[model samples]
Target chain A: MSTPRTPTIGLFGLGAFGRLILRHLGPHFPLTVHDPVHHDSAPPERAAACDIVILAVPVAAMAETCAAIAPHLRPGTLVVDVGSVKIEPARVMQQTLPAHVQIVGTHPLFGPQSARDGITGRNIAVCPVRGRAHLRIAAFLRRVLGLRVILTTPDAHDREAAVVQGLTHLIARVLVEMEPLPGRMTTASYARLMEAIDMVRGDPPGVLAAIETANPHARPVRDRFFATAAAVARRFESGDAGGEDQRRRSRRALIG
Target chain B: MSTPRTPTIGLFGLGAFGRLILRHLGPHFPLTVHDPVHHDSAPPERAAACDIVILAVPVAAMAETCAAIAPHLRPGTLVVDVGSVKIEPARVMQQTLPAHVQIVGTHPLFGPQSARDGITGRNIAVCPVRGRAHLRIAAFLRRVLGLRVILTTPDAHDREAAVVQGLTHLIARVLVEMEPLPGRMTTASYARLMEAIDMVRGDPPGVLAAIETANPHARPVRDRFFATAAAVARRFESGDAGGEDQRRRSRRALIG
Candidate 1:
């Protein structure tokens, strides 16, 4: 009953993403932040005491971070995770947090790089795990932050992201590492591929690893992607005249 | 001594790309088109009679098409083949055409799909093979059609394009075939990937095959891409904690 009618927000982790949330949400809410990196940041206990706590840590650290704040979280406090992959984070918050504390998993599709211009009209996927706090936060995300909210289950988010982010980052990381020659002749599609690479490459290795590894569905999609890529490479290597028809047939199979 | 002050243009093939070129070039020059599929079209001999004849056939048909027109071509006529892959076409034109006929291999990097809005500011790779006519065509491409002309060798164009269009169509063909579930939650990078797919997938099967197969360099690039992708997949599949360090090391190797 002592929780404020307008939730006081506590933001955890001050990495680029955490700082991004702070930059945008700082002015709008009664906000305090906790990041071990910053001496001035409120302590871990202070984050637990807030009415709404946002975890913006790397996915690899989700469980430990959740455990750190669980004991101190008020009965009615809402814990929101801003991790890219949602399934494991949702499960961690469910298991580690006090039964009375509410949890919702969120993946803001745009990062500081993509949203450099602004966050208005951008998308944020909300996977409501426990309690009614998700409704409140989704409304806040929509009305206050001008985000288009897609309410999805944690599994659905990961499944789609397996292909979306999974394929995007997988292709991008390899392309960047290849140091592809600067083509004097580039097509519109090729230019767009480069743009996607630029957008995803700014993410840290841990973030990339988490998206690829932590999500269970990601592995299967990744396997299919590589297998198909291998098959295409083999078909090309064979240099069979009939391979064109075979490639088309395989392409049709994949399209389906 | 008369190669006509303004070379009359003859466009061969009436596929989407050929039609696109016609739409842009039709009004500016004395133009005629010959598509065997169309009853009212000018005959192949008529196409050779034009001072500047453009071959817009599929790469598979380039040699035969060249043979059909070579004997009829006026002595000073410039023969341009707008095939997606250049080396084979360049050689075919050089060997099959009359030595008196000029040859320039061009790959307009836009098609009806990419150029739906119009072709201004788009790129066109001009590989001058057997003539000074390329200079005239490049100037016309820059001055009249507003194309950014990149004058490169056929081998250089194919080499870079292996990674550019080869990687593009290869990935696109796979992604399109996968028919990924409609992602209600899409990111900026994901949207760009989809846009690139849409642009390239509209191209016909023959074009896709030619880009992937006819260009010899494409096979090596495709092999390297899939190999690197497979390595990444294996690293993730192993689920080794130290795999991250290993991945970065291999990444450095690839970058070199």
Candidate 2:
């Protein structure tokens, strides 16, 4: 049982994203994984005693995960969480983990569906919370994984995620609900919109939950979008020239 | 004039789309151009007397343009329109122009912005309203212009356009109005959404007007999109779990 503990990775939560991390990082490192709900509950301390501990649980389960792994974590161990929203998870890891343990928060700006082809050139926002260990993580993501690493603060990441992931998921869900959209007679622009929908349509429920609910900036962004849409709708309904009157005239002209 | 009339193309309306047409077709044929407002008015009669008369005007201006060109069009001449909507322009051309003049309605799916690189592999809906001249037009579009020709009737084109052009323009307009969207830390899906907006943001007011008002099927599609969006908004604002409760928990967990 003399396995060298050279840069071992202990990954928790066998969710969609957890599996993705495993598939990509498995060949490069000695990997140990545990998911209490999905996989065999390997002793928490054994998985936690690795060189790096990655929590891939939902944002809702972040607090409990941190508390469970806190005592077992070694002093120099680096802890990272891959959640859609950055600020909350960053805070949780920084506060709950031991002061000597390093913490980094990352939001892989893609899902299993979007990264289906590959993760090369995909963006990953890395927010350093407790230590400079993120520098190494960012380098590995860029050099080895062929990812685009965005070094940013947790708050800044959430600010942009409000519009980036929030609006994308929100718009995509609504558009998917309006499914059976036109397949024929599509323009270049329409095709692009469909592509955007296709990228996010199959995202897991927790991904949307973290984006729309867990992120603090998400609501304001969503509200602003809805308000703007309502204003546009009102402009059309109020008999604007390009609305009721012009529509009627256009209809009459077509028939006559 | 001693010039040979080798399939001369008479183009009207020197707007963005008209210029695109002139740039593409100018090299292939003897050209006569007239625009009452933009360029010098070369008299409607001269432009209408060519082998192919193209009306690149607004949907609202379709009837007037048709009436102006009807008196001068020769028998066996082809009259085509490049409007966003198909049914109204097709009907207007069929009704106002001389019966002997062949009427073909074309809606180029790619605009100047989208086809800036080239018009190769673009889509153009060609609906034959009066004569079989559309077959030749379709061939030329496929072979010469390298466009994909969709031979659909006026109503069928409008039905599909209502979803394609209508949704693209409406959503684009709302998104454009909400300017300064997330530029950095954007996911691939968000970038695609931005690309869709970029393609249609520069489109003229008349293009949006035609999509939202002129096309009879446009209104219902727009209404359905708005209704679907409203349902999504309602789900969030009603203190839904993924909305308020989880949001509050997320914030508290971050602090504690």
Candidate 3:
């Protein structure tokens, strides 16, 4: 069980997702926030004494930010991350944090618009580096914030994300490359694909680079994606039962 | 200008999209409807007489259906089709309909969901085969129903649909084959992609077949899609700089 006192939360980085957190959590908790870009506009002094420190910056900056904040954290304070990629950040936090400070790595499996209210019914993946802090935080997230908690290792999270994010975004990249900007009218299916493309288009360049470059295991998954696309093209070119056969084979492989 | 006195409408097939029209316009206009599966199940007899006849069946079944309803249409009645592929149905309507009757080919660029209260503010592609009757229907759709109307030849409509529907659905088919089913939890991008896959999964097979097989020009689009995917796979396998190089090359191609 967590200590009953209200946890003071120190939020670091104020990007899009970070801003969303501040908007939702500021009224409810004792919030302290830091952003290098907004150094002159720091939060109130009371918030700096927070018991929980959250790193909500790009994945590439996670290591340096974790190192800078380690000394400021008091004993028993929890350091958590909300990065997209997990394993590397978890390793960085483990190496930089003090022995007494508990490190909990989390990837909230949603974005700002996913829920109308503050984090209700959304999934949060927690990979504990070395503490009971995860359970404490998970309890609060479920009991108070109404989040669905998923527990997994940092390694497993990245491996799965390689296919989930890597392949889907790769497909979007392909569509943008192939088609001219659509005009006049569209079907429901095309409208949906455009929505997917729009979601990823505004992501910071580093976010896309990290997902594509960091995951060594994603090569095979991407290869398989291309292979399936090739088979579909072959079928379309032939216009025989072969296309339908290929479609059936691919559907069974994916759905099964 | 349309001939004065409300032009009676002849509705040939009573499928999902057909039934919706009857529900919306049956009270105002005299509607003559025929369907092999549910000929007796059409609305009451008072809604049977119509000046314009709409053929709402699959492209493969259009010829036989046109023959069956040829004797029933009144002189000067306007004939239209609501099929995905336009050329074949347009040719059949031109060949079989009475010389006095005007022929117009229509492809409502929306599904049954858009027709809930009648297809207001939606798009309908109009391909006039041989007549002035299409002008009146187009005017009605634009002025009364608030539809966005695009007038094009039958061949052009089929060509555009080949890339829009055929290639888009082909990409959906490939993605479904390539990726594993994401459990209940996923990144925002994957969640959006799954929404697209669901839409494609639920589409009618007749729509799918018409988009895939009816367009003769779709083969080259499918070929380019496969070639580009293959190139992406090869670049990823070669390492970071190779992938970066491929990205640069693609951008250069776009610029040129």
Q: Who wins the TM-score comparison?
A: 1
**Model 2 bad stretches (over 4 Å):** A1-5, A37-42, A238-256, B1-6, B38-41, B238-256
- DockQ per candidate, 2 decimals: 0.36, 0.30, 0.21
Cα misplacement distance, residue A123 of candidate 1 (Å): 1.5
Candidate with top DockQ is: 1
lDDT of 2 by residue, B22-119 (tens): 89998898888887664455667788899999998778878877887788999999999999899899888878999789889999999999999998
Spell out the clash pairs found in candidate 3: B8-B50, B8-B51, B8-B52, B9-B50, B9-B51, B9-B52, B10-B52, B10-B53, B31-B48
Per-residue lDDT over B1-256 for candidate 3, one digit per residue giving the tens place of the 0 to 100 score: 9677866666655656678677766777866666545547444222223567777666656676667666756667677888887887888888887787778888888776534455677777898898777787789778877889988888888877776676677877777676565665586667777776776664555566667776665666667666776665554555542345434432322200
Count backbone clashes in candidate 3: 9
A208 Cα displacement, candidate 3 (Å): 1.8
lDDT of 3 at B222: 68
Q: What is the lDDT of residue A22 in candidate 1?
A: 84
- Binned by DockQ into CAPRI classes (incorrect, acceptable, medium, high), candidate 3 is incorrect
| Residue-wise C-alpha lDDT for candidate 1, range A1-256, written one tens digit per residue | 5875666998887878988998998887888888776777788888779988999877777777777787788988889999889999999999999999888999999998899999999999999899877787889889989999999999999998898888888888779868855656889999999999889888866678778888888889987877776676666566642456635433332200
Tens-place lDDT per residue, model 2, A178-225, is 889987788989999999999887776557777887788988988888
Model 1 interface RMSD over true interface Cα atoms: 9.3
True-structure lDDT of candidate 2 = 0.83
